[model samples]
Target: MSKRRKRKPKHFRGVYALLVFPFAEDFHLLLDLMRRFSAAVRYAYNRLLEGKGREELKRQDDLLCTFFRLNTRHADDAVLKAQAVLDSARERGEDPRKVVFGGRKLFETLRRRHLSGKPLKELKREWKEKRQGLLYSRGDRTKGGNLNLRLEAEDGALWLRVNLGNGRYAWALVKTSHPNLSALVERVHASLPYNVELSLKDGKVHATFTWEEEPTPLAATKENGVLGIDVNSDPYHLALAVVGPDGNLKRHLTLSLEEVDRAPNRGTKELLLWKIAHQVVSLAEEHGVAVATERLKHLPKGRRGDGSGRAFRRKQHRFAYASLLRKVHSLARKKGVQVVEVNPQDTSAIGMLKYAPLLSLSKDVAAAYVIGRRALGFKEKLPKGYGKLLRDERFRDHAQGFYASRVRELQAKRAQEQNPYLRRRLSREIGEAKRHLSLLSSLQGSPGSQREVTDGRNSPGVNPWRVLRVGTFLPLLGREVPRDLSPLKVFLHRGAWEGWRESRGPHPGGGPKRANVHFG
Candidate 1:
């Protein structure tokens, strides 16, 4: 068997520290430098986009230095900062011209400050601090670490010296009680290279130290087992499953993201996410198994102006799926834990169809289990029960009929609906129902591997799995993706798929058009 290709083991680490200025003059001086540095960065960003190189912009007599009252090193740092920002924007496919010096959201919030019940002065102050109060200094190995802003460790404590330009320097105490600061202490004492960044927020100055290191060797292995994770947005939770070497579930659990939702501020929320990431990585370390997660694709956060309910939009916005995954992947690498990204195709559908009812696991947990199994190179075969149901002609017809009835009812509802939002919602459901009708119309006589089949339905593809999901989830269950799928267990038994009887007569509560599903 071929071993997995190992990537370069590069580590990025950082710790936070608060800067305590001794004298008021020193505070004011540093604040002035930071505000100028912030302005210089924005100016440099625009200049960089105009094709101006750093060599011309970072000279001591250059306008960037003279106008900003910045030293040559600070001017150079500004250009570097601008280039980093530009590179990040391009990576995210964002319009570099539209980049806001201050965060766009924060700037936008100032316009509607009255709605937040906060004083306008306070709101503007927050915006100004973010937009103007910033400073950065890159470390140089030749200068015994950072040149413009060097860290010093004395008697188990840290201090920072800020070069104030014009032959002046100010010393400030680094206030942090973090236990891991010992590693930083050691690095500072050894004069290892480190980058320092300072920013003002909430009327206080905060500092972050960043450095690179070699990552540890991987200790966890797939041969031991795999810990699979799946993030769900609706309820906002992470479902995890520990699959053994034999592809059987050894354990399962879930971590709630409600606390992250309830956090009062962005800082607290970010800290909570990091805490959760640590818990996940710690579990993998304890199990001595590699972690498995799906390669994420861009998920549409429902537009608030249309399409989605307020609650749904809020959930999607706060999902943190990508954020938590990054934390887990990065932390795992630093700690020498194995991580595997599997193709996310059909993990959800396969789990809902087979394991959700078979093992009585929730849909999310079942999906996680499938991820772990796939990571171990196990293939999913269509269950015998599902294979038999797929071939049942009556089953296919009954499922098709359910959607056909739904489409008629939905179109009538949409026409009568006065509210635009409700009409749009109805129209969407009708479209889905019609699509299912088309899918069922082209059902094959036998189940086979997933492949494309076209027959005037304008469908790109049809497979046994899609047909089964389309037939069962909405037709008999009346839900596209129900939270509790144990109800599907009954249909998993013999003759259950085609075994549903429906009354076409007038319904007891509504009308004759509604078909009441009854499982026999």
Candidate 2:
């Protein structure tokens, strides 16, 4: 065998920190510089785009001047700084223009011009003093130790003392290299303070500043494991599951809005959802595990009609699921945890049907059964008498035969039905229900046979109840397993399996042999 090649680990590049600092007198000067830089950047970008296409224009600078709704002048200043970097780069044969600009200077300039009225000289002096304090009081660097500073003008504002330290200060240099250095600086200053806290990671410098108010740390990953979450409206539930070393569920928790309401009201469900997602991310980071959820594409919606049936009036807010998934996913990524999405179709209901008979019955017994199994570590617990169950083969034979007969009945019924839409719907419903029933029936005879069966008609496949359960718990189960019985096997047994011949050549015995395949 050929030697396996070692794969390289993937690396990610991102802004490690967006420092925000309070506006000081010198902040005005920084703002002025940012405005000029922004103007320069814009001018350069426009000049490049005049003769170039979109792709070329984007490549012409390290950072692009994307305008935001908050401040027009600041946006314009960003453009100016971008232009300056391009011009400077072209003159010096260095791609300074390629450096993405920060919004520090732009915000400072705008704040000075439109919000605050601090004088430039006063602000400069204060900044100088602050630098001196950092050098002397903090003992970080000696005074007059090769401090590099520059002044620039482009967006009707002036920038002064844009300084970079020698080694760790390389980040400062990168920050200032942007055409819109002022804007970049303003953003940094807004987010972080000077010499308050700083660190370097993966070649990037991160800094934090003291602020009176800060957003509460969101719910995060714990050292134990990540809490897998599934978001829904009305009955907002969280299926908190822990992952093991092999990346399978170790323990599962099912917490709902009702449970939350049982305690004193902390906030609205939306707030709770946000907190939960953030906490999950934080926990994942702390625990060094991955948080998994389902990737929901188009959600089922109520059909528009004469407003007669419940189907026509079912209100499903697609945004809630989309937003929660997005928030959790993004938070997970930021916290350096894996956020995965699995298929959402029948994860919960199937699991419930498979594990219910083993649990004590209650209202919504099917849902509770799966939740309890997951919580009790059933997935990790192998059946006690697997050898006996396999040796008997009776359950398997009965399940296969039943599935085969039901498949034929549904196929025939589908073919005879005249209404195309109704025929397809009923066929799918009956087929899936029969397949599920067959699996449950087979599992019933196994060592753990507490699996419960729910009425097919009452439990629509995509019903919210089913959706919430599946989306919440499926990822916790880790991987899909082949059901003991399915329509595919039934079709094959009846010699009516479509696409079977296309899949492979005839065997030496001149017939196809049954193969096990897992469907999710």
Candidate 3:
């Protein structure tokens, strides 16, 4: 056998170039061309479906050329490509409508032809110099100038420039004949700034452009603690587990969204997201911790039924869930927090207790439960006390130890057993049980400690916050929880901080009469 070598950690630094395709003047022309081409293709396909004669179709194609004011060659090519796609789809037992509206294959072909070309690095440099000249001249009459491009590389940083209109963007495709170049063409056509970066560690490629404003920096991660998060429409809730050396909860911080919604601006949504994400990072920095969240990405939404009403509601529910998951992921990455997605099905409802209740379980747990329920031949009744049991620090330790021993035992049994069928059955059952146990164990232990707690019901000596609700928002703190009294008790007291109006100014009516007042 060949010896396996361990892989080393890798990293890379590169710039993200934003290349704009259609210079302002040419954008409308390009849009017209696309619309004309689409209409032509659809027309031809319909003709074919109606069993039109070949000569008649050829005449129609010619007419399409005249209608779009394109040369016969271009029109012919578009017709052929569209027909080929439709024919291919029909052969594969797919609807032609699905194939036409669905853009993956079409876009893939374009990318292969246009985006894959000579090193974009060289083109980017050229564009930068031209852009500088234009800027220096104060937008002097530079007729037929190149499109503006922005370069955001690690070393050079963020800079913008323009390239002369030599048709190099179009010529690159003609020269390379690589289909991938179509991606570059399409981007340029969109008239948005674009750039690409390469990550050497995993050979991962990242592309960014004027699609949306650059994402804010909100990435965070914890070195030691586990962050339990709950996802909801109103607000995202977070709970941190600060464990002791003995794997007990030493302290925790809970954040909710009430503060976020209180902001007056319409863009409060994005601002709130950034604020909460930054707070999570700050918390992690103060007391090293990792983050955990329930993976509710595919949690079914919508009442069960067969009618269109149910379908429409389900679709809306799916959209909401998807949007929530996206925000969580984006925020998590910006914070550098290790986000572990647990299952949602059982985490919220199972074995949930008062003091360390599983407010939201990770998606992984839900996945495991799905497999477990199937393997155990149960009719899928919700697991009882599974959530609370999983959250128990002691139970988690036991489950981990149990899984390790069970795996070893299974290996030994496999080595001794002769019957393949029995061995296979036993192996599957063991695997399912282990998965379930592992998920439960994760909830039982605090985020960082390796030690196992033997008692499932014992308080981990952690202070529970009285005022903090599951999804309330919190401001950034400069210090870790105070050591004198429990942090939880302090948090409860702090929650009663005076209102903004009382602390900053008198009433709007210019009156200072009220003794005291509180609003929820």
For TM-score, the strongest prediction is 1
Q: Which ten residues in a row are the worst by lDDT in model 1?
A: 502-511
What lDDT tens digits, residue by residue, belong to model 3 across residues 1-520?
9989987322212123222333553333333444455566666666666776445544544665566554443345445645676788898788876553324554355446554455444444333322211111011113211232223223322223322123321110012223344444443444443332111111111232322233333243333444444444322344444433233345555566555445587566656766676775555445645555555535445453422244445444523334444565555554455455544433322212112223232322322332222222223321223222323444334334444555566678777888765576567646754654444443423442222221212224321111111111111111111111122222222322222223443222112222221111
Per-model TM-score, in order, reads 0.85, 0.34, 0.34
lDDT of 1 by residue, 132-173 (tens): 889999988889999888887777668898999878988889
Model 2 / residue 372 / CA error / Å: 14
- Global Cα RMSD, each model: 5.1, 18.0, 22.1
- In the range 1-520, model 2's lDDT, one tens digit per residue, is 9999997433221222332223353333333433343344444466564554334333423343232121322233334434555666688675553543333354365457544445654455443332221110011123221122222233544232333222212213222232334443453334322222233222222333222223233343333344455554434455555555443445555545454344345446556656767776665665665565655666766454422234323435322567667767765665556554554444455444333323322113233333323322334222323223323344344334434554565677788888766675656646664654455344433543422223222332223223212211221121122222121222223222222234442222211221221123
A best-first ranking of the candidates according to their lDDT comes to 1, 2, 3
Worst 10 residues of 2 by lDDT: 131-140
Each model's lDDT: 0.82, 0.39, 0.38
Q: Alpha-carbon error at 218 in model 3, in Å?
A: 15
- Candidate 1: stretches off by over 4 Å: 1-9, 109-118, 233-236, 256-275, 303-307, 384-388, 441-460, 483-520
Q: List candidate 2 stretches off by more than 4 Å.
A: 1-223, 230-236, 242-322, 332-387, 408-419, 430-520
Residue 424 error for model 3, in Å? 44
Residue 331, candidate 1: alpha-carbon lDDT = 89
Model 2 TM:
0.34
